[model samples]
Target: MTVTLAADSGRLPEYPMELDSAQSQRVERLLAGTVISLHDHPIRLPDPLTAETWKLHSGQSADVFGGDAIVRSGLNVVLASALAEPDQRRLLSWAAAMRPQLLGPELSGAESLALAMRGEGSAVLLALEDLGSIGTDLVGIEELYRAGFRSAGLVYNTGNALGGGLGQSTDGGLTEPGRRAVAMLNDLHMLVDLSHVGDRTSIEAAALSTAPVVISHAGARSLWPSARMKPDDVLRAVADTGGVIGIEAAPGSTRVSADTTHDLDAVMAHVEYVAELVGVDHVGLGPDTFFGDHTQLYSAAGWSPQPVPGYERLALPDYVAGMENPAEAPRNAASWLVRRGWSDADIAKVLGANAARVLESVLR
Candidate 1:
């Protein structure tokens, strides 16, 4: 039950999770196939010494993915807007200059898996969390793709030139440029993620894309009624396009009831709801976890959930029990499904096959 540190001595520290016999067996079975996290922030962690600056470290142990079968892929943010840097333009410029060097080589999801199978390293599909890094240029998409990003979310939490995000007071939907972005992404064979996009924008982008579009990390609003959660129609839109809705498990985002603490059950409830609404083939896990105290990270970065009417006073948890970080989410998710009597085929689809199918179809 002791988790080892990253292979490199300079990596960030990791904690261990104690699993009983049954739990260990379930995890073993879960790792029997290809597992893909639709969305996550693997590198972002809270600064232990001071909240004022980020603890950007390079250490990622084998536990980060639990097993070789699990592919760590999704949104990788260079600079999350939550940190509130005073000079945005300067940071963006620096990020653009350093991004190519930062991402050494381009590796497709399939290639990453091949490396893992050979025991070289964990499979990872690099993706940009938002297109904001590109600013106003459509060519930036191609640049980023060449820089090794296989997928990208159009907007963060607010309106950008591309589209409106969940944080906007009124969604203006996808603009002409947004439409172009969608088409460009589809043409380039990069995965389009709508997890943080506004409802209208998500629908429009999903419909416009020839390729399958994913809500990489979000939950069913019918179950939780949070603005951050996606509605039935939006879920249908993505599924109808042959895409998947990876359930969100970040703190209070997927709570099923008035429970003060968010746990694996709450996350699974969202999964079950999405499955029933759009079938199991269109669902997966995108816990959106990282390597630190997420709630504290949120507070330190001045980020808070967008309050919805009548649910404005929602109580958020410090961490999601059994899914506190990237290392724990996939194992716990697969174990939950196994405990719930899901067939191995169905579990495999949810774990990675479905997302891999989408990746294979789109990733160049």
Candidate 2:
């Protein structure tokens, strides 16, 4: 699937005509009133790779204020799998048994304290265990959804009971159970995520889902035809359903090397491509920027036998050189958009407005 756009284009339509001009102006004014600050805040979203990598790269030094930073940044929601009671216990136990040497002394202590202080923090980490290795019965998933699993994907880079992944030997589509899972998720108001699901799975899920589904973090194949990107057809399908596709950082989804010089440009090219395909409303950022060492955790978990060659040492800085922290990401992206001639309103949508819109629909 190819997506082409005329050069020197202006902004696209914001939304359906259901919103009156006065209402639309009010919405735009409210969005514009949000000042993009320069403070470095703790990241609120869960990027498994980032959490694990931070521990490995930077020795586990307990940050009592880390949770505070996350809240101040207006990131009160976390989509995580390992933070739930049972899953957290399982992960800690597994880490202790499998890679005791990798564990920093402070990690175990912090985990214990965190569990004891559960609910003291303002942000909610929606822990979701990988059902890839587990059977596809989805019993636990049903319970989690009832408890609030607002976002989920059938598989994550490997063949699972639900479906095949991009890394699977056979790029199979949705299995019977996978199809059933999608239906159940839709029925339960869970947003299906297709970031790592194979091409066939993406297409099938998009068709099956009544609500718009998101590829939470991905790039454009037109920019780089890596498995991590969504095809133009898939992008259109997502947009047609009113879903948003988030462009990830360079290392995870793009072909751009980690060279500080051209990496940001490469990332912007992807954002532009997706915007061209589905317009600005369907394009956003979920850049999976790992602040520390992820390769070590991947190896420890026995998830990948070999390290991601050439990417083993890649960290958050490699993707956005100067923007090493979460707060910096929005600022950097906004600056780039302005340079590309985007209006403040358009830039605001790309930064967070678009993602918020999709979340409000699916999570409500």
Among all candidates shown, the one with the greatest lDDT: 1
Task: Give per-residue CA lDDT, model 1, range 225-333, as digits (tens).
Answer: 7788999999999999999998878888888877445788889888888989999999988887665666776665567776756777776786788766665677677
How many pairs of residues collide in each model? 2, 3
Residues 118-218 of candidate 2: C-alpha lDDT, one tens digit per residue: 42332232323334533666675665554433566667776577888867667778889888888887777666888778888788888888888877667
* Overall lDDT per candidate, in order of appearance: 0.69, 0.54
Candidate 2: misplaced stretches above 4 Å?
Answer: 1-65, 71-130, 146-148, 250-252, 257-262, 291-319
Query: Against the hidden reference, what TM-scores do the models get?
Result: 0.80, 0.66
Best by TM-score: 1
Question: How much is 45 displaced in model 2, in angstroms?
Answer: 14
